[model samples]
Target: MTQFEALPYRHVLTVPTVPTAVRLARETTEDVLTELGVNPRHPTVGPALLILSELVTNAVRHAAAASPQTTVIYAAGEDCLAFGVHDRHPYQPSLYGAATVTEGGAGGLATVMELTLGLGGTAVVRGDADGKGKSIWITLPF
Candidate 1:
């Protein structure tokens, strides 16, 4: 009889703030998830990669000024997978504000929020140790 393990896995990867960072993060995340027993063809992989790409792209595009690199933290629990992107940009977005989705599909955070919430998950921001940066964490329950 095959039984499922409830062990959790976590990985943190830091990459230079460049256009290629998006691809790097995605590849690493896929490998890590697979190593942790997630099927490579899992349904969550698609949305998870999209969220990671968006987060890394935002860091590469907007935070390069104060943050030369971005850190991606990937964690998976018994029933959820979580990703957090950290940068020293000092600007914490307002999660309390109305959703950012537009009629014609304005991407980025809006898309992230939609996918995250649709998965019955939660998203929150965590400040860096030095208080000069923030990490946006998206946790989706499977």
Candidate 2:
């Protein structure tokens, strides 16, 4: 007989605040989910990927101005998967109406919120303990 591991698998990745960091985060997330036995075609995977992209992109574009690196943490429980991005920017992301979105910029944070809600998940934004940075997290149920 084969033994199975317990729930709440966790992984943490740190990357430089560069454009390529988004792709790295996504790839690493996919690998971690696979190791956790999450199906690639599962409904949650797509939204999770998008969420990771948006958060990492935000970190690279905005938070990178404050710090040159950021960290991504992934936790998979029995019925949910949570992802968090930690950056050195204490400012919370701004939410804007759809009509105010420009062509090449804006709307990323809004999209993250919408997709998280659509997945029956919660999105949280808060400053880190030392008051020197911020962390954004989203939890989605499988």
RMSD of each: 4.8, 5.7
The positional error of residue 112 in candidate 2, measured at the CA in angstroms, is 0.4
Show the colliding residue pairs in model 1.
Answer: none
| lDDT of candidate 1 over 1-142, digit per residue (tens) | 0111233677889999889999999999889888878887777878888888988998888899999989998777777888789999998886534247668875688777777777676788878888899998888766
- Candidate with maximal TM-score: 1
Cα distance off (Å), candidate 2, residue 126: 2.4
The TM-score measured for candidate 1 stands at 0.87
lDDT of each: 0.81, 0.82
lDDT of 1 at 101: 66
Clashing pairs in 2: none
Q: Which stretches of candidate 2 lie over 4 Å from their true place?
A: 1-7, 94-106
Decoy 2 TM-score against native: 0.86
